[model samples]
Target: MAQNIIHLVNVSKNYNGTEALRNINLYIRKNEFLTLLGPSGCGKTTTLRIIGGFEAPDGGEVLFNGVNITSVPPYKRRVNTVFQKYALFPHLNVFENIAFGLKIKKMDKKLIAEKVHNILGLVNLSGFEQREIDSLSGGQQQRVAIARALVNEPEVLLLDEPLGALDLKLRQEMQIELKNMQQRLGITFVYVTHDQEEALSMSDTIVVMKEGSIQQIGSPIDIYNEPKNSFVADFIGESNIVSGIMLRDYLVKFAETTFECVDHGFKENEPVDVVIRPEDIQVVPAAESKLQGEVSAVTFKGVHYEMIVQNNSTRWKIQSTAMAPVGAKVGLQILPEAIHIMKKVTVK
Candidate 1:
C-alpha cells in the first residue's frame, strides 16, 4: 500500500489562553483532495497553517511521508500555500511572480524558465506570462497564484479559500477547474473553506470541525447521509432535526407519531435527534398522508417548490415539485432511507 502523504497525531494549538485546535488526528492519502470544512473560527485554518509549518503545535507532532516535521520551517517543508487574495505583486508580471521562488532557491535560469512555463500551461495561464498582476480578473489572478505555487512542484498544495475572492459563477467554475487539475496532476491538495457546497462538490474526504475539535470525517455521502451527531448533521447541510425518543432498535417516536427508522443501538426511551432534509420530505394529499401538516408558506424555486408546513405544534420545512397553495392542508412523509438518527451532544 502507498504511504499516507500527511499525518497529524494528537495535534493541538493554543494562542494565549484560547485553544485553536484540539487533539486532531488525521491521515491524508497520497494524491487525494481533502478538505478541512467548518464554520469560521472552527480551527480549520489553524490546522492548515500547522500543516504548512506556519504555526507550531502546542503538543503532538506533524509528519510528512512518515518523517516528523513538527519543527520544520515553512520554507523547508514540501508544501506550498495559496492564499485567498492571490497576493501577487502588482508590479511584477506573471512570469516574474511565478519565478520568484525558484530564483530565491538559486535555480538556474534555464530550469526556472522551463518549470515556470510548464506550470503556467498547467494552470491555463500560458499566454499571460508578461501580464501584470493588476491587469487580470479575480479568476485570472487565482490561476496565476496556483501556477506560482505549482512551479515549485511541492508534494502538497494548501489552498486557504483561494476562490473566495471570485464572484459566485466564477467561483463555481474554478471549483471544477481545481478538481480537474488535481486529478490530472495526481498531487495532494489540502483545501480549507467554510463553503459546505464547495466541500461537498469537490472533496474526496472531508474533515468537519467545530469549536477547535473534529465533529466528523468521512466521504461527502457519509457526512451528509449518516452524520454521527446533531452538530454534524446541522452543520453540513440543511436539515430538519427533531427531538425524538427511541422506542426500540428500529422504532422512534416524534411528535406523537412512531417512525420506523433503519438505525439501531439506542437504548429504549433514549432521547435522540432525527434529521431529514427539506427535499426528503414528500408532500401528498391530506387524506393519503402519513404525516399531516398545514401549509404555512409556499414559494416557487425554478426547479422545485419550497413549502413551509406546520403540524400546529411544530413547523417543518419541505421542498417539492408539486405546488401547494398557502393555507391548504397537506401531509408530509419521509422515506425510511431519508431519516437520520443521531445522538445529540451538549454544546460546551
Candidate 2:
C-alpha cells in the first residue's frame, strides 16, 4: 500500500465573514499525482496554500508523514510551489533562475552548477541554460518554473494552476509532460486546476471540490464513471442529469419511460438522479431507437458533431460523428452501462 505523505484532518478556513473551506479531510499518497479540481472560488487554491504552509487553517491540523506541520513556516517545510504566473525573475537567465534556491541556501557553487545542469536536462531545456527569461516562450517559462522547484529536491511539489497562462495546445502538451515528469521523479505532486480535462488526463487521483468542500475523491476513471452525486457527475464531465426512479434492480424509469440499466443497490421506487454522458449516447434512425427526438441544434466540434436533441421537454446534448440536421427526427440509444443513477439531494 502507498503510504500517506500528507493528511488534512477536519481542516477549515474562513476569509472575512465567509467560509472558504468547511471541514476538508484529505489524504495524499506518496509519489502520487493528485489534483485539487474545481471551479473558481471553490477553495482548491486555498487548500493548496494551506498545504504549502502559505496559509494557516482556522481549525484542524496538517500532517506530513504523521508529523503535524500546521505551525511550520513555508520556508521550513520540505515542499516547493510553482505559481500560475511562473514568477521567474526577468533579470535572471534560465540557469540563474533554477539555481536561485540553491544559492539562497549558500550551497557550494560547483554543487549548484551540477544540480542546475541535471534539472535543465530533466525538463528538456539542456541547451537553453543561458537564455534570458523573456527570450523563452510561455511553455519554456513554465518548464523553468518547474525546474526551479525541483532543484530544491523537495519531498512534495505544489502547483497552483501552473498551465493557466498557456494556450490550449501548449496546455495540453504540458499536461502530458508534467504527468511523465511526476512518474520519472517518483515524488508527490499536489496540483490545483479548474480545468476538468487537465485533472482527467494527468492525475493518479482526483479530489473534486465544490463550495469549500470535497464532492468526491477517486481515480479519474472511477470519478468519471461512478460519480457519487449530481454535483460530481455534472462537474467531472458533460452529463445529462435528470430526475428518475429506480423501479428495481437493473431497471430505472426516466423520461417517462422505463429502461434497463446496469446499476442496482437502490430501494425499489427510490427517487434518483440519472446521468448519461454525451459520448455514450448514440444517434440512430428514429424508427429503431428506444427514444425518438428531433435534432434541435448541431455544431461542428472538429472531431465530432455536438448535437442537441429535444425529446418532449428535455434537451439532451450528444456527441456523434453522424450529422443530424436540425428538424430531423433521430433516435438516441444508450447502453445499459451508460445509465448512471445517483441519489437525489434533499434540502432542509
Candidate 3:
C-alpha cells in the first residue's frame, strides 16, 4: 500500500469573516501526482498555500509523514513551491537560477553544477544553461521555475498553476512533460489548477473543490465516470445533467421517460440527478432511439461534432462523429451503462 505523505485534518481557513476553506480533509500519497482542482475563489490555492506554509490555517493541522507541521516555517519544510509567475531573476542565466538554492545552502561548487546540469536535462533545457531569463520563451521560463524548485531536491513539490501563463499549445505540451518529469523523479507533487482538462490529463488523483470545500476526490477516470453529485458531474467535464427519480433498482426516470440503468442503491422514488456524458450518447434513427429530439445546433469540434439536441423542454449536448443537420428530428440512444445517478443537492 502507498503511504500518505501529506494530510490535512479538518483544516479550516477564513479571511475577513468569509470562509476560504471549510473543514478540508485531504491525503496525498507518496510519489503520486495529486491536483487540487477548482475555479477561482474555490480555495484550491489557499489549500496549497497552507500546505506550503505560506499561510497558517485558522484551524486544524497540516501533517507530513504523520508529523504535525502546522507551526513549521516554510523554509524549514521539506517542500518547494513554483508559482504562476516564474520569479526568475532577469539578470541571471538559467544555470544561476537553478543553482541559486544550492548556493544559498552553501553546498560545494562541484555538487551544485552536477545538480543544476541533471535538473536542466530533466526539464529538457540541458544546453540552455548559459541563456538569459529574458531570452527564454514563456514555456521555457516556466520550466526554469520548475527546475529551480526541483534543484533543491525537496521531498514534495507544490505547484500553483505554473502553466497558467503559457499559451494553449505550449500548456498542453508542458502538461505531458511535467507528468513525465514527476514520474521520473518519483517525488510527491501537489499541483493546483483551475483548468479541468489540465487536471484530468495529468493527475494520478484529483481533488475537486468548490466554495471552500471538497466535492470529490478520485482517479480521473473514476471522477469522470462516477461523479458523486451534480456539481462534480458538471465541473470535471461536459455532462448532460438533469433532474430524475430513482424508480427502483437499476431503473430511473428522466425527461418524463423511464430508462434502464446500471446504478442502484437509491431509495424508491428518490429524487436524484442523472448524468450522461456527451460522448456516451449516440445519435440514431428516431425509430431506434430511446428518446427522440430535434437537432438545435451543430459545431465541428475537431475529433467530433458538438451537437445540441432538444427533446421536449430538456436540451442535451452530445459529441458524435455523425453530424445531424440543424432542425432535423433525431433520436438519442443512451446505453444502460452510460446513465449515472447521484443524490440530488439543494442549490443555495
Model 1 pairs whose backbones collide:
none
Error of 2 at 299 (Å): 2.0
- The model with the greater lDDT, 1 or 2, is 2
| Candidate 2 lDDT, 178-232, residue by residue in tens | 7888888888999999888899989999999988989899999999999999888
Model 2 misplaced stretches (Cα beyond 4 Å) = 134-137
Q: How accurate locally, in lDDT, is each candidate?
A: 0.89, 0.92, 0.92
When summed lDDT is taken over every stretch of 10 residues in candidate 3, the lowest stretch is 83-92
Alpha-carbon error at 62 in model 1, in Å?
0.5
- Candidate 3 local accuracy as lDDT? 0.92
Instruction: Enumerate residue pairs that collide in model 2.
Output: none
